[model samples]
Target: MSKTKFMGSIGRIFIASFLLCLAVVVIYPLLWMVMNGFKSNGDMLSSPFSWPRELNWQNYVKAWNRGVSSYLTISILVTVTSTLTTILISAWAAYGLTRVAIPFNRLMTTLVLGGLMLAPAVALVPLVKLFQALGLYNTYWALLILYTAFRIPFCTFLIRSYMLDLPREVDEAAEMDGASPAATFWRVILPMCRPIIVSAVVLNVLFTWNEYLFAMVFTSGGDFQTLPVGLTSLMSKNGTDYPVVFAGMVIAAIPVVVLFFASQRYFIRGLADGMGK
Candidate 1:
């Protein structure tokens, strides 16, 4: 083979090897967590790397009964509700910022993007006071509101970037046909924006599902705890029961893993166009 072609082949092989190692680094912990969940605490401590004595289904059952089920349900509700709202609100904001002839548009974009820079931890105390004042403390609404609000900036940025590349011809054609701006947005732009919408939804789902700080602080009651907080509580409650804790973790991880895998294609497609610019 030519020298250039031979070097290109070597480069490809080297890159592939690097990525394989990285994948193992990322995936092995998840495998270990799941595998260890099937083993007893004695087995975990004594022979950490060895196969389980048996699949300890009891661990899952115990964990589920000990608030994991309730925590999981609450997480699902918050994630679904907040993620859908975040996407809708962000989509409208993005569309308005992109399509509407609003004043101070540049300033608006800057403010929206600026949200990505703000630290959620920094606002915890103030947010706590505000929520308590609003009578939303220890409630689902606190978490739902926080999730939607924090995610809006990032989601709006992505959707707006994708929308910027959209052809104006369809919008103009719709306008000529006497469709109202809202109708055109609903029926026309939204349908065409599916890839990015899916991407934003999945991204928000993962965030809301895994988010701990807000969930922990906003909801004081056990009935309102999410997976991350619930898992922390589980660890404290069953401090010595490693298998049950691990089982709770596995339960917590399954939905996000399934979601990312299922929507990965659209997720990547959606981000690619926006991030490229």
Candidate 2:
């Protein structure tokens, strides 16, 4: 073989091997956690690496009955609401920033994108006070609002980048057909931006599902608790029931994992398209 062809083959082999190892590194811990959920405390302690001798489905039952069910529901609620809200607002903001002619457009873009730099930790104290004053503390609204607010900047950045690359002629065509701005956005732009929107939804859902600090702090436990905080609480209370704890973790992880895999195509494509733009 030619030298160039031989080097290309070597490169492909190296890349494939690296990706295979990376996949194993990422997937093994998740598989291990799932396996442990089917084990008893003794099995977990005795043979952490070995497969469970029997599938102790009772562990999952116990986890669900104890609190995972409620936490799962709350997480779903928050994730859905927040994801929808964030996407709508971000898409609209992106459309306005990219399409419409407005004064101080650069300033507006800067201000909106500037939010990405604001650390959530820095706002915790002020947010607590503000929420408490507004009678939103310890409420689902608090989580929904916080999740939407914090995520909007990044989502908008992504959608705006993607929108910038789209042909302006579509906007003109929609307008020539007597479509209103809102109609144009909804009918022409949104459908075209499906990849990025799906990507944003997946990302927001992952964040809302796994978010712990705000969930723990804003809600006073019980009904408002999301999966991450609830899982931590489960671990604390059932520290000895290793199987149950693992079960709760597995339950918490399943949705996001399923979601990413289901939308993997759109997710990767969206990010790639947006970044390339």
Candidate 3:
């Protein structure tokens, strides 16, 4: 073999090995958690790292029946509702910011970007009190609105950055054909923004799915509790049942994992586009 070819092959092998090690590091914990989920309580305690001799699949059924099913439903509702609303509202905001002439647009963009700088904990106390006074505290509306509010700034930032890259001619073309602004946005801009939209949807899904603190503090009762809060509550009640707890964690993870893989292509493209700006 040529010396250059030999060196390139060696470099490829080294990079492959490094990435394999990284993948193992990332995947092992998830695999371990899944394994533990199939163990009995006693097995989990005694042989935490070992594979179960006989898989106790009963924990999944128990966990699901006891709490996960209801909490999963709540999570699905909150996540889907908040994400959809955030995308729609943010899309419009983004389109307007990019397409329309507005005074102090730079200042407005900075203000929206500043939302990500504020810590949720710093605002939680006042927010809770505000919700309480508004009669939305401890209700789905409180959590839904809070989630949407916190997420909108980021979503607007994401969609707006991507929208800037789109050709302005499309909007102009639609207008020349007698399309209204709303019609142009819905029929022209929206269709072309599918990749970024998918990215926004997946990202928001990840945030709203994995979110815990807001759900815990804002919503109580099984009726309003999302999966993370309900799972934490389940851990409190079944502290000793490691298998059940792990099972609950695993089950809670499935949807987000499914979402990530389903939209993997667009998610990466969106991240690239967002970062490129």
For each candidate in the order shown, give its overall lDDT on alpha carbons: 0.91, 0.93, 0.89
Clash list (residue pairs), candidate 3: none
User: Which numbered prediction scores highest in lDDT against the true structure?
Assistant: 2
Per-residue alpha-carbon lDDT of candidate 1 for residues 146-239, written as tens digits (9 for 90 to 100): 9999999999999999999899998999999999999999999999999899999988998899888898888766479999999877666435
Report RMSD (Å) for each prediction in the order shown: 1.4, 1.2, 1.7
Go through the candidates in order and give the clash count of each: 0, 0, 0
Model 2 over residues 50-154: C-alpha lDDT tens digits? Answer: 999999999999999999999999899889989999999999999999999999999999999999999999999999999999999999999999999999999
Off by over 4 Å in 1: 237-239
Stretches of candidate 2 off by over 4 Å are 237-239
Candidate 3 per-residue lDDT over residues 113-146, each given as its tens digit: 8898988999999998999899998898998898
**Candidate 1 lDDT trough over 10 residues, lowest sum:** 232-241
Question: How far out, in Å, is residue 69 in model 2?
Answer: 0.2
Better of 1 and 2 by lDDT: 2
Candidate of highest TM-score: 2
